[model samples]
Target: MGVIQLPSPPRILCFSFHILLILLQQTTAERELKFVVVVFRHGDRTPIVNFPTDLHKETEWPQGFGQLTKIGMQQLFELGQYTKERYSNFLNRTYSRQEFYLQSTDYDRTIMSALSYLSGLFPPSSSQIWNPGLLWQPIPVHILQKSSKQKLHFPLRDCPRFDELQNETQTSPEFQNRIQPYMDFLQTMAVNTGLELNHLKMLDNFQLWNTYDTLHCEDIHNYTLPVWATKDVINKMEKLAELSLLSLFGLYRREEKSRLQGGVLLNTILNSIKQAANSSKQGKMEVYSAHDTTIGALQIALNIFNGKLPPYAACQFFELYQESSGRYSIEMHYRNDSSKDPYVLTLPGCTSSCPLEKFAELVSPVITENWSKECGKQDKMKDIFLGFDVAVGLLCIFNLVLLYLLYHYGRCRRRNNYQDI
Candidate 1:
């Protein structure tokens, strides 16, 4: 989201090679994109966290911290244009809410990113142009309230088992062995940043990530770095950040942790894919605008993570295609580098053209029928109010408590089933 210029061609977009594969599948060799799902990280922005000795403050950035930047807008705009072209044959010439859907985490940057992407994906047709002066038209980008239990927000903090898994990940022998050489580095970073990161556990928790994010953002913006944060020092910090990201969803009991974190999102995506494959009337394409960690969690769940921090505007595509034989196949591709084609991602143990049923079977180990119970969490309420999206007739224990309960229950807590989406 900083000043890093996208490599020229001004359009660094990616389309899956399926454009050719589907052609080969059919006698006519025509486009066969049935349904598509896209999950992408928000474009770059100001750093969200700062070390105690940080040089920049919230006010220093134009829109304050964690908000989208001009570069980010351009990035998503180009990505949207790429999407429009990629699905040209499949998509209607004009915007149609029934054909496409967009959602984003309840954040300024993500909402903004979705809007920017929509601008390029559905630039105004003559009929959609409410204002001829403006080349854009507003489109709906659905969002759950911030308090809702949404899967798009990964490493969801409400799950006790996930927190336990993270603790175990830090103490695992494999993790200790990986960080053994960085003991001195942690101590040096602690001294330089005035942060308490003398132990690997501390780094795994957050201190190291904060340092790396701040420096990475600063470097992206071409800000002068502190003397202690030399090139070599930043490289070491980068490694620790990568490890920290991996710990968030993997490293120990990967499948169990995934069932609680990334698997939740995967479940939602799979359900949509299944419904579309079955000829459900749902939209043809779905896109989620979220964070880098969301991308990491999802890729880790799929067991195809490249083990690198997903860069700004990195988009992952999940396409459902019906082959010439009438069977449905799912294909995944990752577009992290704008300079090259999206890296093809095949579901493990399955071919690139993975059958929908086989893809579900391979990922079955991570998916859960009930994420709440699997997470070892109990949502307690009046037994009478059980199974109700909204609890009516609050207890009369106290007026204030009653009002709070009403407000809380008024917003239906989403179930892991993902049908609500």
Candidate 2:
């Protein structure tokens, strides 16, 4: 073998300096994750009975309509397991009330989902196991029903301004143009569903979405679809629903719409992030269990929406990290599929790992100081009367027109006994 010679002292010194520089850079770039925020939709749930023509009956579902299924429970349990695995090293081995907080919308599916999630996230360790037979522990999931200030529901159903905005969107030339080709198909659907031809002009796009939802839910649970709910019909309904939903949050006035809807939730999450950064006592995780609309609205506000219906059990995640320099950075990830890793979502205006301050500034325009004021809630009586008048006017038209060719495009079609859904 050829003899190997040692380098001179100067050469060795240079090599040592290069190694030191590499270590210094590595240390400077290192970051420790400190906090997490997750906003997620509830697991699989039965559809509420809004589409009268569907064959699914509330009695057929063991838990009644709009309740969670066992499959849903298992799905969330898996999510919890995934979360536990993801943070096992970072979080304490035993459960700590001080490190985690959970909230959910006041619905059977969401509350159950939260519970199922907790069961998976923190199964009792040997130290905390209370009973020999039971492998789980109780964790509180906060919910408040019918609260005036709750920020979890989407589209802000009570907001007159949002309603007004929606009507405006429905009437825009672009909206009319988009739905023009589907008018006859819509009429055929209406007649097939027992909704009269005259009533077709009065049907809202959301109602069309409801019809699709009923069929979609039926398929998920292995229920046979009616002859009317053909694959072609479903495909069209899906397209319409996607268009209508995206338009509500993005098409006409994205920032303004966000200021009224998703911005409320965004504000809450940002403040929580700031508090976590500034305080030593902040919880390690904050979770909000809500619905698809909630996640869609939040994503739209953040300018990271993927322009598709968020599937059941979807999650939008915010993770905070403390860098070696003592500054904080945030990373956003979205998980809508259980089969693959969550997708890394970069804020529209920043790098993948964005600084906390810069992230806040970029999203400031969407945040609202007073949601009620921004939503046109000046006086109780004024809002009620105005809302009634708008509702009456709104029901006269299909908001998202589908009978434009057969009927006079913009003429109102009246319906009796109109009520909010």
Candidate 3:
């Protein structure tokens, strides 16, 4: 009681001091961000569809189905320039073989887009140039084999659950409401094009998707879409394509799907960042060259779609900055519209710059398979018991057969002994 007779400071002052200390701690924690990961859709591409009656069907395009157009290359190049400007501080003035890792799905358009982007992003700096004419430097762009379904690619690895989700999306009340207007638009399209409603449904098929992609590419490159297709129709068709991306990702209908594709990509980026932060060496930027589907899926996953599709040259940028206090922060920038400054992304509990570890933790639930739900409780143990029972029954049958053979042999031997006697 005597020792506590005098309170050192007022309770309000003490509380204020604690609050200030906490703020300082938070500020210190916020300073240590150090990695960047980016996943983006490929720039502009030719149409992936062409009507049967159209004069410039598949025959007009050189290397068929969903190839990148000249405009697509230009779009990626512009994107590269933008990237160079955005990360000028973190990245070396010149592109270094050691500093960057680029990967793409094994698709012609994606591969080409990645190459084009590299050309623009790392245009020969004054010091690195071997010849003035050669603006291109060799940078390794890794391609995942088409068969490696594990690696990130569009129309995500076929899972029955995802397929069911897609079906549900098609039939969902919200989707039905959204598509009702589009259905009316389809009827008009059918009347104008002399195609039946049934045939119009065929437009949703893979072949039709391919035709649309090819034509879209051609239009972008040379201002040549079918004459029957008016600017308004073309715009609508483009929106439909964007919608297709959202559908393919299954993000619009199911929150879980968003976590798998987009969330996984985010987690991967954060993991890379965490690794970079712990290391003494400066981390390299990660680049992904993929389809509009890839971008759409990712954006839907991140809940960042501005209700407009990402254009041919659209890019998403993730930057990790290390503060003077040795803390890290993350900032996401989207360059869907090249005309405007990139839009920043902010997640709850994290600022534009979030810690890598926290980011990974946040997305963990999405990537991890819910085994109990995926494999039903009843079916889970059925297979194990069924297999064990079958094995044991087979063993018992074999032993019984062996005993019978032994008994018969003994009887036969005794008969032979009696004959000898």
Candidate 4:
């Protein structure tokens, strides 16, 4: 005590400085996120198509089929506000032209939804240099077109492997088990409607697609659907559509296609992260505006199927930050509504702040073709065989029906001759 009492000013000064340095470092770390990636579903709209019995048809929608509605615009605007608040610390006080980028699948509704969302996210601030009368300034929104066969937007590309995956899904034991309940429900619907289960128009995938498209068109035109298709039916149909996307992406087989698509998207994300890890420039955020199908497909790929369609404005966000140890970690958040907080996701064996390299490795199997090679050519051939079997079965049934009719006619002719004799 006596030794310490000899006025240790140097020691006191050093200790105070050290404490201040620690506080400064903590503050910097808290505010030092460098990059963000967000993928989102497009906002609401009239049904893309209608059913056979729809009362209000495609012509009723002012913009024609598949256009966003006024309410959709409002929903996206609110979503933009939520995004702004959630990332306020990482984002600039006001959006900077240089700090953000956007991309959308090439479709009117998707592109327009992105535009609408940005309008609310970065509304004009005092520092904005727009012409006095302008409501907003232009931001660059990129689009990817001709990347695949189907032009219907994200989750609609015609991949042969994806088709094979869908076939595998139907035959998979797990899928049959999961869908047995729904099949029972469909049978109940058929009984109530006095429709034969086989004759039920909604049984086939294309028929379901047509029904949805027709409903979409009708909703746009302000036409009404049949009593049988109450709001609940429409909602259920939407869920089925979302499940179809998962089927295509192999979500049902977590060890297979989910790994591939998830790996592909994950690889793209990791590459973006590594590119940003060393950069000292103001960090950037990339937003992808797309459809529910796209969100569903990606979710299946990631083993995150939640058993419902992602709402029109649902979003998945990825943030990258650096730790004091000089390693980078990633955090993922999902926002499905304007009023709710985002939910966090941590990879297996990783904390909420996961190392970038580890994250890449965890999902590497998804993007590489090595796993597909293991499935072998037989899986592909099985798909072809199953398709032909269904086609030939239908032809045989048709021929049988035709022959039965002819036999009945000949029997009636012979009966009439005997009566004349």
Per-candidate Cα lDDT values, in order, are: 0.84, 0.84, 0.69, 0.69
| Residue-level lDDT tens digits of model 4 in 220-284 | 44565566677777776565555555555654566466544445555566677778897766448
The TM-scores, one per candidate, come to 0.84, 0.82, 0.76, 0.72
Scored against the true structure, residue 319 in model 4 reaches a CA lDDT of 93
What are the clash counts of all predictions, listed in order?
1, 0, 34, 17
Find the number of clashing residue pairs for candidate 4.
17
Better of 2 and 3 by lDDT: 2
Between candidates 1 and 3, the TM-score winner:
1
lDDT of 2 by residue, 272-299 (tens): 9999999999999999989888998999
Q: Write one digit per residue (lDDT tens) for candidate 1, span 57-159.
A: 8888888888899989989998998888888988887899899899899999999999999998999977788988899998999985678776587768777
Put down candidate 3 lDDT per residue, 329-364, tens digits, no spaces: 667788778799978877555667666566656556
Better of 1 and 4 by TM-score: 1
Output the number of the TM-score-best candidate: 1
Q: What's the CA RMSD of model 2 in angstroms?
A: 15.4
Give the range of the ten consecutive residues with the poorest summed lDDT in model 4: 149-158
